[model samples]
Target: MEALNEELERAGAWVFGAGLEPASSATVIRASGSVSMTDGPYAETKEQMGGFWIIDVPDLDTALDWAGKAGAACEQPVELRPMQRA
Candidate 1:
């Protein structure tokens, strides 16, 4: 993972990355007619996002390459999604 990060940094595509705490430690807040708070993930599912990386690559192909490396390093499936531009 460190090697991948280094490679990304070298390529100037590394924006930021981080690992999150367990889903059990999460707190969900909602605001509708009234504000409410709930414990745990917003939804229960077989898979959860353990961590993520934000990179600035030229295109989907480049991002996919990095995601593949990350998946191999972690021995887990990685999800890739483009960020919405402001």
Candidate 2:
């Protein structure tokens, strides 16, 4: 895990979040005519997502570089999302 963080740092990106939490503890929020909130995640099956990373980089290649390392650390899926431009 430390090595992954270092790699990202060296590449001028940074991990934003990470952790393990129960599926039941998760709540999904969506928007439409009115705000919508749902219980648990959309996927109720196992292989639940436990963590995430937000990295600032020029493009996908940089993001993938960090993702591969994180994936190995947890031996599970790691989701990546670009910081929204608002």
Candidate 3:
């Protein structure tokens, strides 16, 4: 993963990246007329996001290339989505 980050940095595609704590450690907050708090993820599911990376690449092809590298390095499937343009 360090190698992947270094490669991304060299290509100027690295923006930000991080790993998250386990879902059991999550806190959920809700407000609908009032406020409420809950423990764990917002939705009960078999899968959860373990971590993510934000890359600034020129096109989807470039993004896919990075995603492929990331998935191989982590030995896990990676999900890629574009950030909304400002």
Off by over 4 Å in 2: 27-46
lDDT tens digits by residue: candidate 2, 14-65: 7465666878888888898899998987774666877676778788887777
Query: After superposing candidate 3, which stretches have Cα over 4 Å from the reference?
Result: none
CA deviation > 4 Å runs, candidate 1: none
Tens digit of per-residue lDDT, candidate 3, span 1-86:
99999999999999999988888899899999999999888686778888999999999999999999999988889999999999
True-structure lDDT of candidate 2: 0.76
Q: Write the per-residue lDDT of candidate 1 for residues 30-74, one digit (tens) a residue.
A: 999999999888785779889999999999998999999999988
What TM-score would every model get versus the actual structure?
0.92, 0.62, 0.92
Instruction: List the lowest-lDDT window of 10 residues for candidate 3.
Output: 39-48
If both were scored by TM-score, which would come out higher, candidate 1 or candidate 3?
Answer: 3
Measured by lDDT, the strongest candidate is 3
Q: What C-alpha lDDT do the candidate models reach, one value each? A: 0.91, 0.76, 0.92
* Clash pairs (backbone) in predicted model 2: none
